[model samples]
Target: MELRLGISTCPNDTFIFMPIIHNFVDTSPFTFRVVLDDVEKLNGFAVKGILDVVKVSYGVVPKVKNKYNILKSGGALGYNCGPVVVSSGIFTVDELKGGKIAIPGENTTAFMIFKYFFGEDFDFIPMRFDKIITAVEEGKADAGILIHEGRFVYSNHGLNLLADLGELWEKKQSAPIPLGAILLTDKLKKEAKLLNNIIKSSIKFSRNNFEIVKPFVYRYTQQLDDDVIKKHIELFVNEYSLDVTPV
Candidate 1:
């Protein structure tokens, strides 16, 4: 069977998927045609039920639940790994009310968290995740929610963090903050267990053979230094990526 697999270009995704994409791990029973884009785009694909498998924001799962079932492996869920709200100048979380803010996407968990914390009173301008820091730095928006590598580099752009949405969720909930999830459509439900095992093996293979996967990681994240890229992978691809059930 040929499966359409969609994932973000973020370091964690690139790292965990390297072995599978490179055929280093056995991906028998299915051949995958991959689509790489930002997480929000993948979420959109899931919403449209265009892809057989995709990495999507956890916020989108409920909306796409009828079509997609959350997979047990290859997801991002952890503490202190949530989106941050940043601005060019110092501001409190409460002060952000009624201000224009840039978010990664409307369907992103980051945006959902922001709304949960601050409500819909503010103007939310949705843009690519990487563009959010620049949008705030340029005054295009009063503040922006930073995710993925943005969390690592926002301060370098002179952005001030007003709130850590993930921390808030952690305080309120017992479960770790679920940023993204791997979703497989109901049409493929019967094969979900097999696909989950394949994903788990891929992640284990990549970690055990880090040097072999390092080149692929660097290739997708050439703009980020080796240290940032490594940290990005470490922060996002935790035990949850291998199995989300326990998390």
Candidate 2:
């Protein structure tokens, strides 16, 4: 059976799925036609229930729970791996109140935690995650929430971090931050275990054969250097990538 699989272009997603994309694993009776896009777009797709499988912000779970069953493997959840709020100018957390902020998406986990962290008093401008840092730098926004590689590179753009949402969540909730998760539509509910295993195997294959996977990752994110790409994968794809249970 063929499945429509949706994922982001982020390094962790690319790294985990490289083996599956390159046919380096045993995926009998199943072939994935992957749709690579931003996490917000994937979240929109999940809300619409268009894909057989997808990676989406964990914040979208409440919206798509009726449509999909979340799988344990192939997810991004860990400590110190959450979105960061950044700005070109220094602003105290209180000063950011009522200021205009650029966000990845209204439905993203980042936005959810952002609201929980800063309260619901700020004006949120929803945009593509990749454009947030630039928007902040250009004075289009008072601050922006940075996810994926943005969490690492925002300082390079002369942005100051106002808050690390992950740290806030950990301190307040005392748990790892859940950034994203893999979901399988209810039509394939019976196959959730099989699909989860396939995803876990793909992650394991990529780890053991990283040389073969690195070029694929670099190809998709050519703007990021080797170290950034590696760091992105190392930070996001951890013990949780194989299963959602916190270690």
Candidate 3:
């Protein structure tokens, strides 16, 4: 069966699925029709139940759980890996109250965490994740929550960190932040283990063959600095990706 797979174009997502993209692993009876977009768009695909498999923010899972089941492999969950609030100039979280804040999407984990810490005081402007930093820098937004590659490159753009929501969540919850997750539609529940092993195999293959995967990661992240791309993969892709050990 051909499964429709939706994923973000972020380096980490691309890194984990590199082998599958290149058909380096044995997908067996399952072939994937991949669709790449921003995480928020992928979340929308999950909400609509349009894709057979999709990558979505953990924050959006509650809304989609009825139609999808979380896959153990190919998820983004780790320590110190959370959304951050950034501004063009230094400002405390309290100082930015009632100001315009750019967010990747209302359904994103970044926005959910942002709302948890900052509350509903700010006027939220939802846009594609890539546009947020530029929006804040141009004074279109008072601040923004940075996720994906933005978390790593915000400093180079002269953005100041207001808070690392991941760190805060870890402090309060005492567990790693659950960022993104892979979900298989409920119809595939019986095949979850089989599909998961294929994903794990693909992840393992990518890690062992970084040189081969590097070009694929770069294809989607060409605009990012080399160092940023490296850190992006290093930080987000870990043992948890192979199988998210419950915290």
Give residue 147's error in model 1 in angstroms. 0.6
lDDT of 1: 0.89
lDDT of 2 at 47: 95
- Which tens-of-lDDT digit does each residue in 1-247 have in candidate 3? 8999998999988988878977999998999999999999999889999999899999999999899999999999999889899997757998888889999999999899888877998899999998999999999999999898888888888999999999999999998899999999999899999988999998888889999988888888735578888788888998889899665
Best by TM-score: 3
Reference-based lDDT, each prediction: 0.89, 0.89, 0.90
Model 1 stretches astray by more than 4 angstroms: none
**Candidate 2: which pairs clash?**
none
Candidate 2, residue 221: lDDT = 71
lDDT by residue (33-75, candidate 2, tens digit) is 9999999999999999999999999999999999999898999
**Steric clash pairs (candidate 1):** none
Checking candidate 3 for backbone clashes, the offending pairs are none
Error of 3 at 135 (Å): 0.5
TM-score of 2: 0.97
